[model samples]
Target: MSDTLWWQHGVVYQIYPRSFQDSNGDGIGDLEGIRRRLDHLCWLGVDAVWISPVFPSPMADFGYDIADYRGIDPIFGTIEDFDRLLAEAHARGLKVILDFVPNHTSDRHPWFLESRTSRESPYRDWYIWHDPAPGGGPPNNWLANFGGSGWEFDAPTGQYYFHSFLKVQPDLNWRNPAVCRAMYDALRFWLDRGVDGFRVDVIWLLVKDDRFRDNPPNPAWQPHEASINRLLQVYSADRPETLEVVEEMRAVLDEYEERVLIGEIYLPLERLMAYYGRDMKGAQLPFNFQLIFTAWNAAAIARIVAEYEAALPPGGWPNWVLGNHDQKRIASRVGRGGARLAAMLLLTLRGTPTLYYGDELGLENVAIPPDRAQDPWERNEPGLGLGRDPARTPMPWDAGENAGFTTGRPWLPLNEDRAERNVASLSADPDSLPHLYRHLIALRRGHAALSTGDYVSVATEGEVLAFERRRGGVRLLVALNFAQSPARLALPGDVAGADLLLSTQPGRDTAPVTAEWQLGPEEGVVLALR
Candidate 1:
């Protein structure tokens, strides 16, 4: 609120474009649909909207396998539609962050198409192509995240090209200066088109092991885990030279003012911090996803907060993510009641918090039947339950057919109970989860201590998570109960004058706490310390 960077203090809401809202009768969400839904984001109090890719694609991996970096897919609309969306979003005082897939391109991409035509093509070096192993197998032991070998043979060139995810999405050669320059120009194209920032996709995988070393097996990987986790990916991702690519992208972003860069990396806290770049020049928000992996226990969460806080490089700002298109929803993972506590933790934490598209309404993972399952990963490996379709269901806008997301059938099914889980229905009930989210967001915005203050973990009893946020003379104590059974926490200080600013439970606020407090099951409260 006081000259702080907007992204450093504001909340980011991610929108999976295809499922957010479908404007036409096409069953897929378009930019116009997103334009119509800006009011919903405004009501939710999000400062910025980070949209997943809507670029032209072959749908091999949904929008992740980008075919044209500069053009919008026909299903999503045209360049003019995007321009209008950007203008409308900014008009509503919301920043728009586009998903930038720099690691790879669709096999249908013109560059990739020409590159595979022959090894002598000028664009051949734009993608990673390698000769097969002596035994005529994959280049090495690298495996595609989606499944199978990462290398796909090209009969014409008599070589194999690398793909980190799907064979349809070929990895780009960041080692080639020309490729890096082309990607930078693509970023410049969007910046010129007035995009506020980019959420760089799989940024850690930008550079790879130059020597083509085989990845070591993951000793802790379980059979139930996705096949990609069988190997640790140490050589395939997070390479030492990845920083070079990060620096180059950061330079491109730096040319624009008041823009942010967020990187989606799945690494431990130690290695994750490196994306902040030397001298704090990497991604503006390198996405602290510890919560996604941390066990849902009070002490465990407290340790995560402490360790993650400690892990922040000097001058690096912290951020948190609870759910995304790739992972299970917080509500489904933690159960219905636990989502309230999650919202409290996500909003009150000492950093920028990214709220996934529909988590506010307690949206859970919907079961996609075999007949309607659309995710490529799930189709590629049907039995592993590795599909993301469950998490990418259409948003529930109202108690109408198709949840009012689309006039016709939705691309993905709505939450089965969309009648009562819709936004309009929840907005009518003051005690609904989305309203609680709004309360927490407003509380964070109005209180500097809650937004950007120093986080001090306070002592708490079993299953109780308590922390104090202090900014100058303002100190706010936030206490939460993670379990279903009620628990009492000893007051850490003279709480005789402390005021309950907000509470997860309805009709429990603006009151004084006694020497000891009884916290309702799955309850969280923010108190103003006098």
Candidate 2:
């Protein structure tokens, strides 16, 4: 990490506002709700917070389909509420980053509304539109990420508007300079209001193939509730033209000091790095999602980590994520016990670590019953299980009515056993997940080796992951047993004397220094090397 860029070294906590806190008693969270939790964030010692979108929307996609670029949705609160939240965040010494959706807009947006009314409208070309095929079908064989054709037909204009997601979210025409300027202006609107940065959504889909070509069929069908991941979306998304737009956005960010832009790109590592731009003037951080895809094993994670560090461009920063609203919770994905090991690595890793809202309490996604499903993707395609409602459920703050989220019924059901896993309960227990998180975060903050150090993989084998973090002359080794039984791992030949830092092994004081160390089931240990 650069000494000048201190923000690059600390932890980042991601808050999905709708589920974080409910201040208005409407059973839905708002900006004011977030404002009330500034102290909690400060106590966690995170340097910044990345909020999911709170922009005006029709709720079709739960605020992802932005309807107004410069206004807050009524459900969240007014512009005044946002100002209060921003002020409180800064007061607590937390930098704020908003979710910026640049690739598409809600169908109900004024621009889209006008564009769809007539072909000659000035905004008609603001979005990608195409005529129907000879057989009265979609212009191409491209499929929506949420299922069905990516293009939605409009009978009035005899044309189809492209939507990479739901039909209601039409893709913006990045080819138009006006669209680029408009989105850039939107970023300025918030930056002017004291926002520290932005997290660009679906950034890889900002542009498309100039020739309206068909995406080839995907032979492997991995069914999710929204859409089948069977088709190769080559022409539909991750186009080469996307980088030009990123450069333009980065230029706008450059005008403001310390304003950062991060992007969400699901492409393979090689292609994902391209979003950073060849000139290294695009998004400040292209989210490293290897942990989300790789299996929970020492060798697998070590190899992926090595590959990602090697793949980064010179001077570019790296970021890591364990969970997001779009996917299953880290606990659910990597098993309940695996969550602790994952958290340790996330906080101690050599990057800007992003912690999902309730991850500190080891929150798992609540299982949503079919009748109560809220995600549009689930509603549109019943056969596929791509819906995100499981991970978007409300947070459990206390063991009280509505999990202390609200006085009334929540929009989504809380975990039935939330009383046992609530923050209030965990905060009282010395050995709770929340306490572990605080210890690890504090340790990371206090030790330079854990925060901005050069990461070196320590040699180990058999269900044990070990690595050494070094900065200046300080070096520390951290290891975790990821299996269900005791595993003996041999340390690298270079290791001499090591002082124990923290260990989850029961009844263990200091682990005996041997060529081989035995780790209990689902246990972790940290040591200072001499």
Candidate 3:
């Protein structure tokens, strides 16, 4: 990679605070917990840590529903704890990115409380508010992302307020200049505290249809799908006006030098590009969830990669994510064998890659029993198998009780295989996923072709995905077998034997390869073209 920008050349690791580690044995992860784990990330070879929200909140929707813009929740740690984390992270040459929730605040927030108290409240205009219809119902037909109506009637104010997810999270009116100023100040607050950047939550939902028009119905929505998908959401999400909101947010970020901004967006490739803003003034990277939802097939993944690469603005950097706090784990989505292939795909790609916590060890989703289910999304849609608790389970640090996450009863149950799949377990195994991840990371660090190379898809036999990563005079070939059955892939006719640099299979030598390579089931490798 060209050593121009750190973010451009680095891989990001995402940590869900409540599940990363528990320093005080409170059964919940805190800033101190994260600080203690800095060495782990350093060894993992990630350049930055993007932490989810740790702000003061009522836990209505975990930290996403924020009650305070500038303070940390007691369940986590204080501002001082966060500052110490930033200090230690920087000491290890790791950039820290905090989560910024700009779309809404908890109902318990002072601004929301005041706004809900009376129609004349000064902050009433700060949040989206609308009068009931002629029959005294919700202002519009918008549906909450979690479930039910997006509007919640506040009897005291004799009106309804908007929420995109949970009612407790009242959507802020970006149109309100006052709200914009306040949110911008929040960005400055963290920047002043030495955070490298922010991962803005749900940025595309910042603006809505000003006319308060009802969204159209989704004709193709399946009955088994999440209730929120019942509508087309034309008036509620991915609004064109949101691009201006992104520009404004970028302006606030511009106040600080060299600070990156990452936006959480889930729009299609075409619509997702707009978050870059009119003149490339938007977020440095709009978090790409393509890998999270894309079908785990060679052809499907190849198309997504090609399409996404083609869709980028002239200067926009690309990013890829396999799993996150809100989605199914990659290991669970694709089996253990597939995860290795995924790692090869993720680390060798052209842009930055964000690794979710515990993914290095191939942590699969831990099943949460009925009594243990904690995710609001799943709680909102019981029995539909939609809860996120499975993915957000506590990280398994070691083979100790409670997975060394907490001395007390963990906030969530340890996965069944923690003793075998933890950092300590896999880090020692030469062929383990964690070891493979470390090797891939270190290799990418030393090779421009693997880190920032121009990707060219290579034709291969069935279930075999081969691509060439080229930079300067270096060309590296990456081949992956998507299935468990062996597959024979024919290398390019113009190319001769290659020097094998690394392979998912254990103890594989960096040797010469022939025109045809037999790919072991779910095997992948990086080759230095000779």
Candidate 4:
């Protein structure tokens, strides 16, 4: 255990700043608010906190469209405020991970502003700029992830700039040596400030096809899907050159001590494995989002876990994500019962686990009215159910006004059941989801087998998914029931009986089991095999 890295065995908790807590009562969460809530994280037993971007931005894509790589947004407090938050988090033995958006910057950034002024501007080549096509349209047929063409025409420079996401976010030219130097400097700035590491945003999109070729059309595209999916994005992202960029970033992190680099990549498992780089020199943890996108059933989950375990590069680590700011809450995706089981599955699995801010309390997505919508994707493409506001809503801290997240008006509405689902109410109940999360985390930390053991898939009948985690002589068994009715699980002949260590259901029968065990609906249990 002394040789293991913190990220390898510890949990990473993601905090969406604006929705976390509002200290100044500006209807938005700030640095001080996060510092104030360090106690909550310590109580939850997470080892690290990964905060979304708080860099200065025009709010075009919230904080994702960074205006200044080195400055904190005034809305999120200044540089000094960030320092205080970092110090506080460190004092509590919790690592702080910043969201580094290296792929693009706000169109209003000084670099972009200077680049758009003239073709010969020293910074002109800092971004992806191309001359208009012979047909006088975008350089190619590439489509933006938000909508429309991926190229934004610049009237002053007579060129089209590429933006994989939004027009306000101009893609950086990672091919340019100068861009790499500057971004690396930005990384050093935070590292020097004693921050732990970064969760690089859209890391796969850092480099693009130098030819700027048109992406092939997606044959599986349906009208119901977002327009961006119309193309296969063959040339727009995940280019071969991207790995070089990732390797360069990894080199920067290597310059620091024990710092981790987590890449946010949304690719298929085969392609995603490459992000680990040769000998795991790339992202220490290329985020595993399979659980977020997979069907919440015993068979589907079991298959995915097995596939992911098999796909790991030699000595490469794996991670799991059940919910995030970008996705619907796990509680809403699976029912409350299943959310509890999912928690058990996440913490007990091998490798790291990243927990979204409010999921521990079983918080569901709040319904945002059409008029209150804030996500640019939802605004740019209305009625498509593409909005993320529901998932990014304020965290419910208490039953008081704004659910104790803010004294002023909350930027987004709270869950309709916040009165009962908040931390204050939930923490008081030992059977609450929050307590279940705490217990699971504690159990994982207390046992080496649960944290760093080898995973072995266990075959089970009906809707129960079972597995064994073994480290030397210690073996732990985990069984989860995905159905609404009781499910029976037969222990393998290798183990005749075991003592129950913990269960998702409160007050569940903990008597030692023989060769078989019965699991309640949506229940999961961890056992120390005899």
Candidate 5:
């Protein structure tokens, strides 16, 4: 691994605060809840923790809609609580990365309040605002991710502002230099208070088409109830000018020693790599969601992995994600029984891996009843089932009344099977998924080939998956079976001196220079090259 970059050295854990823990009896999670679980995170062997936004918000979009860039939400806790959480995390030898939402702010934010108060307010031009069309409708036909037109009418100002997401989230005008500087200053404030880095939110949307032209029609639109994916998101996101802002953000991180920034970009592999900026001056690691978004097959995964590796520019780091608050958990996506295999693959990959909270224990999405759903995507339109509430369910720590997440009613219910999957129970079982993750992470850290290695696609056929990770004089071979029946794979090359490092099943002698080996259904193994 490179000596200059700490981000390149290890894994990052992403914690969605609302579901992590609830310290108060109010049923909502707080920083104190997170502070109490530092030891658990440390024990999992993650190098750093990337926390989701805790900024003050109207809760219009859960915590994504920011009302104040610099203050913590009262529901999450005060600034003092954040300081305490940071101090505790550092004491536990864990780095802390805060979520920075710079693309837009809640309509209730003071900047927007003043901007909407008058057409001449200094903050009026800070956001993207334009007069309605001749027909008294939006300026353009761009659609919001949450289902309506991207432009919202403000009666007071008689103008419409761009919002790629929820209407409450008005897009910021990054073309305005003052807005750029202000966002950068907010980032610096967090760094000065001891944050190790940031996970920049929707970074590619910061810049838009200067002409405000209508987006071309999307040929790929397949509506899920009322999703706006039907229309192409041309003018709203992934604009070229966004790269300039990324470079500027990178410069800000460079000002502070050891400060890192990762971007959440949802573009295709080709466009996503641009977030690294020219010559690697953009994000330290732009998130790779291929593992989550693409089909789960050996050939498909192999092709995507190869494509991502080829897309990265020199000096740029790569990161992989399997699940997050926005999507279904990996265990649920694959099969509940395949959770350990998924962990092995994620940890053993050749990049920084981000493990979402509750994923370690095979947590599945909550089946939210229609009446209790809290997500705007679901609440805005009934029966669409677009709400992320199912995936954003509360974490299961113990088999207590509320899964040990809180003393009061949980903001979200724990899975009824929590009795079997809770942390306290899983930690006791030697073969539990959580224990498997711990072992897999330790194995990755022990082998240099697993961390910063060059990945080689090993030729194999049938229900078996195989690959080689090599760096310097080290090489490790990884293989997994996807079928229910035993699958045998022919060794790619002479493996006369390979030694077993880790295997899903026990009491198997895997030596003596055999040209073929058998793997049970969903089985995985790592072979250390001699």
Candidate 6:
């Protein structure tokens, strides 16, 4: 085996800045806060930290709608603070990845402000702008990902500007060479500052249909779903031209050494594979969310893993994500017991894995009252249960007031069970979820088989999913029980017997196994084959 790159074998930990920690008593997480809490990540054994957007913004989308690409937001901290955080993180051998929002900018951004001034403005074409349709309505039937028409009418200019998300955030015209140059320059600014990589936001939406055609209506549209789902995003997103744009972005990153580019594309597995580019010149990792979207069952998960592995390009690498700032927490999705099993599956998988903040503590989504809902999508479409505040609540460091997240009132409420489901409380318990994660991470780091081995599916019976990771003589078997009842996993005849290395169950003995292994409900185990 060749020497593995850090991103290929390392685990990535995502930090949602606003909820991670608050060091200034400002009731919000900032750069200084992340700097102070770096030790927690070190202790947890994550290789890299991918922080959400920290650029200057109007807080419209809680930092996603960036107004200034180069400057740090005052709420987060100054440029000096970010430099310090980056320097300290590097010193601790932690790779830092920033969120790059290239699709759109805040409506208040200077580019948008100048673009909206008039039709004749030099910057007018910097964004997607067009004259109103014949009936004085939106140019097409495209709908924003958030809600309503993708086009927002600018009364002064007598034209409608297209936005893939909120009307306040206008999509940049990547077709415009100037816009591409400017965005590329913004990337170089961070690369020059020594950031390791970027998790690009809405990367597939960077380009759109050149003709501005109406997206076809979805045949399976339902009123219960978000308004954007009413129509297929054919014309508004995932255009063929988008791949070329991805290649260009990759070229920018290639200018730097060993810097990674991770695109956030929410397409099906087949479509997602194309983002790897013709010769693996596109994104280094195109954020695989299969684990998050797949049915939480043995058969379903096994099928997805097989299909994804088969679909990878010759030189392409794979990655997995269980939870993120946008989705429901894994504990809430699969109960506490299953979370431990899921953690094992993630760490033992063939490729890279990203662990969301608070997942190690088995943190579930907190219920956010209507008055406390901060997501613009939830505010615009009330009662649809689309709010993300529940998943984005502040981290529970301890059982103190505000769960040790803040001395002031928390921007969002903490998990109701924070008293018991917190780092301080759980870290002391050897059987806690955090300990499970630490052990699994250490195991992956220490063994070449677990970290960079080839994967082979193992035959299994009932609710048990089994696979083998082998690098030459080092062979390890992983068996997981997806059901709530006990299941027996039959080993292959080629494997004479196995020795238990680790088990999700707290007190399970690491004894030798012969023929078949019995697995308790929601239990998962790693075995060393004899």
Clashing pairs in 6: none
Listed in order, each prediction's TM-score against the native is 0.98, 0.97, 0.98, 0.99, 0.97, 0.99
- Report residue 86 deviation for candidate 5 (angstroms): 0.7
Task: Give one digit per residue, the lDDT tens place, for model 5 in 175-220.
Answer: 9999998999998899899899999988888888888888887777
Q: What shift in Å separates residue 469 of candidate 1 from its native position after superposition? A: 0.8
Q: Could you tell me the TM-score of candidate 4?
A: 0.99
lDDT tens digits, residues 90-129, model 4? 9899999999999999999999999999999999999999
Clashing residue pair totals per candidate (backbone < 3 A):
0, 7, 1, 0, 0, 0
lDDT of each: 0.91, 0.86, 0.89, 0.92, 0.85, 0.92
lDDT-better candidate, 3 vs 5? 3
Pairwise TM-score winner, candidates 1 and 5: 1
Model 2: lDDT equals 0.86
Q: Model 6 off-target regions past 4 Å?
A: none
Local accuracy of candidate 1 as per-residue lDDT tens digits, 306-328? 99998888898989999999999
Weakest lDDT window of 10 consecutive positions for candidate 2: 221-230
Tell me the TM-score of model 5.
Answer: 0.97
Please list the residue runs of candidate 2 whose C-alpha ends up more than 4 Å from where it truly belongs after superposition: 1-4, 222-228, 504-515
Q: Write the per-residue lDDT of candidate 2 for residues 1-530, one digit (tens) a residue.
A: 45736457878888899999999899899899989888888877888899999999998998999999999999999999999999988887789999999889999999999999999999999999998998888988888877788989999999999998899999999999888888889999999999999999988888999898888877775553235467788888888888988888989989999888889989899998888897789888888888988989988988888889898888777888899889889988887788888888887778889998988888888989988899988888775567788888998989988889998779898988898989889888888778788888888888888888888887657778899999889988889888999988666677676777876553567855576667788888778887
- Show model 1 residue runs off by greater than 4 Å: 494-496
Query: What would you estimate as the lDDT of candidate 5?
Result: 0.85
Error of 5 at 382 (Å): 3.2
Clashing pairs in 2: 218-230, 224-384, 224-385, 224-386, 225-384, 225-385, 225-386
